[model samples]
Target: MHLKDIIWMGGLLTVLSFPVSATEIEWPVYGGDNLHQRHSKLTQITKNNVSGLVEAWEFDTGINATFQATPVVQDGVMYVSLPFNDVVALDAASGKQLWRYEHDLDEDYPICCGPANRGVAVSNGMVFTGTIDARLIALDAKTGEKRWDNRVVGDNTGIREEVSRLDDSELGSVSGTSGAGINMAPMIYQDTVIIGITGVGYGLHLDATDSDSPLGAVVGIAGKYGRRGFMAGYDMKTGKQKWQFDTIKSKNWEGDFVTKTADGVELPRDIAKERASLEKYSDAWRYGGASAWSTPVIDPYTGILHFGTGNPSPQMEGSSRPGDNLYSSSLLALDANSGDYRWHYQQVPHDSWGYDVASPPVLFEITIKGKPIPAIGQAGKTGWFYVHDRRNGKFLYKSEAFVPQKNMFELPTSEGTIIYPGVMGGANWSPVSVDARRRLVFIAAIHWPVEYKLHQQPARNGEAAIRYSSMSPLNTPEKHGLLTAIDLDNGEIVWQVKTENPLIGGVLSTASGLVFTGEGRGELMAFDADSGEKRWSGKTEAGVNAPPITYSINGKQHIAVAVGGNRLFGFKTGQKIKVWRLP
Candidate 1:
């Protein structure tokens, strides 16, 4: 009964007006609200009964590999989060573990993406998480007990964090690697949780200055005594740090660009990488492309705080630095109480194909030519679906619909807009659903043209060396992965449903017309949000890449998922969370 006394008695019964219950069973966070739009206006589980459903329970976290989080639930309880940073709490109708905190991780942090944790941020009774060994714990949401552990990026930062600390025969440097952290799922926003660090900077960029990416941040801790990251506030009741935002724009650029050292000699920076302990304090911390990695859409009706930025690294190339790099892959619109900015919408301006707008923008409200406005519609991977105007970022379109585009600047007009659903567009990171009472919105896509193969590796005693670029072989074939259907009054797309193993998981629509999803092939189906047909299926022995939730509990109505392991196969079904319900 304490989520601030249930939001102060649901805002005092909506100001003595009563109403407001709207089906009470919660899915709580991740994309259920804070406007992530993995929408769910509760439809009593539809598609004419989702094929009579089944399963109702399955748990086995036998410690597999990459279980992309997303379980959350509350009141009835269920928290999940495992991949290396482990965190457990279950009882949402009998899964029973009730508390398991496992966190010792030290195989030598290399992580491009593996020990991924993504799920757990409950607040009030506690239950926070973020650690690939980078730290940010917080438990006890009913006795998981630990209450605080904020390390927030600390393997040591100063004396080169003690010379990258690796004694004992240099301990093979970080053997088998388990070392890096945070894969997503941390947005409390009021007691200040914020998080956003999925990599890139761990190698540093303005030619990588050193220490393991201090230039790729978004921090903001403070739940109850553990002060961390850039530090600012939280002394209130004692979570520590009250304010801080670092971005000092520094550069190295490996002498603007020129390398040839496999044996030749042109050394500049990344001698062998890992440097960035929050150095530049000013040029706004410009080291290279931004890295906010999805999950940020606050808008309690515009107290405004949106997010989505990435791919400005050496991963792909916009030649080098160039303009339009402001705030990195752009979409920011801060002021969530001083993170400032307020209005940006670049969606791949100089982007280069590591396509940044990492997905999950969803904020809702439709209408275009007739202008109903109030939008925030994202769906990117640089393949495009943009939609802006979340109170003033406007792009309701006079043009802005891109694909296979190429204006390369120098334009009096068309400089960028060709975006044929390239980097897994229409949706990626699985999560797109909005019923708004059946006005409809349900995404799922992946159409190919991955393209991006830059490469650079020779900055020896000075800096800049570990470039990391390779991706352009996702030929999913069969027309590639769509689920489309747009027309929230006129942006037009209206009917799509083309799949062949390319939906990328996370979607659930109801009002009883059904549209559940989770299938990169581990099945878990049901369609027909209005003629997409197909109606029922189930498999999930693995690969559905998380994101699918629906509830009811005592009255029945299930349908959940999280088949585990992602970043394209990591956790391997061994980490499970599967539900179905109907009987």
Candidate 2:
């Protein structure tokens, strides 16, 4: 795909906007402009003085929780999310809180993960967030005052009553024992904001688990209205549902698709196509699991959306869904408007490793084998870095060593499946940044094998949850973390650096020619963006998972991170914001 020769955006008709300059300040949105190019054009904080950069101003966001939120900076105000569902706007230069807005927590909300927000989206003059308690809130960027709060996922009221209705089975599913909610950042499209859901596909009902709730879905929401998914678009100004594009439309796809004709919602056409595609298909919705998990990168050039899919449930038991899964554990490039499939590449087809290829796919132009290929790269939880020809989903060699495994858990079909990048994922949600000038892709990964299991314990509260969970196979060299810089041209490893903790968040590479990543132990470090050599390391006072953002405020460039002790980050922990700048 190339640049948009036709630059007409139907959604943002009124807002006069400037074209995204090739090297304008990014940190524009969560994943760095729908293309998910975490790559930045800022180079002022390069290698030479990265070490010389020290703590300038520090402000703590909160405690040991899932701080997946990366701060989004625009104008001169920096917007970020705190431990609970709190939103904070701070002076870019002072690190002093300008305003703080909090989302009420659901006493019984099931958090598959923790109380961490992935990040915020800034468009117009507002910041957007899908909060922990299942609410979609908008706050004025300048004041941190609530503009509107819409329950995006679940209602917090009477959550305790809801909890009573659940048991071991139902509770497990809600806890991400199967997959509750772990979406990255929201994508801002025109006047509408886009976000995806990840609730382990099957909706776990009160009495029992149906094993088919349709957790994975990509929805178009209104930045103005605080509306939920695509079946409806909210008015950005009024916070009202404007239109709805329910991908599944009706809930009973496993059977009948009953819909309110008046609402413009109907049975999903994709379900019908899938039903027709199946050799012995009965129902598609009852068990359609190809959830659009991560945020999709937009190809402004082709009007296409790119994203990764998660594992099909009854996940450990692959025998459940059966045929070549259309999208699970796959990389998909689809038409943004119709949700029509363009081209797809399943990293692990009929996946069994629980290796859901759900990381935000980074978009960039790479020179591969002498060809300038615009590509999409993702480091799946299965432990592999996948780089594909973004134009056609074609394969490029993976940089990891190919070891012969017993194939003890699952097998591939006659079609040759590429080897080396197992799903624990050479690099997962911890995002990677590319240095376009240097021609390198920086990635952090957990090199381990996950033991597979479908069901281990007796059903509880009528739900089946993930059993015997652990991530031991890949965290090898025992307690080591790795930062790999790949030569984009040949898909070869240029530099391999290992740390003590699993790379929890991501690496931030700047025009200053440095890469910044936080340790699982809560310390943030800087490396030569091109050489992978350590420049400096200091504790953040907490385990860090949120990606760090560097911005120039009043002529001074500073780096700041949210701190907390994440059991997953594994680093020595503390809670307090840490900041460093050039003295």
Best candidate, TM-score-wise? 2
CA shift of 309, model 2, Å:
1.8
lDDT value for model 2: 0.56
For 39-115, candidate 2 gives per-residue lDDT tens digits of: 66555676766767777777765554556677777776777776566778877777788888866776665554445
Q: Model 2 — which ten-residue stretch has the worst lDDT? A: 217-226
Taking all chains together, the TM-score of candidate 2 against the true structure is 0.74
CA lDDT of every candidate: 0.55, 0.56
Q: Top lDDT: which candidate number?
A: 2
Q: How many backbone clashes does candidate 1 have?
A: 49
lDDT score of residue 361 within candidate 1? 74
Worst 10 residues of 1 by lDDT: 218-227
All candidates' TM-scores?
0.31, 0.74
Candidate 2 C-alpha RMSD relative to the actual structure: 10.7
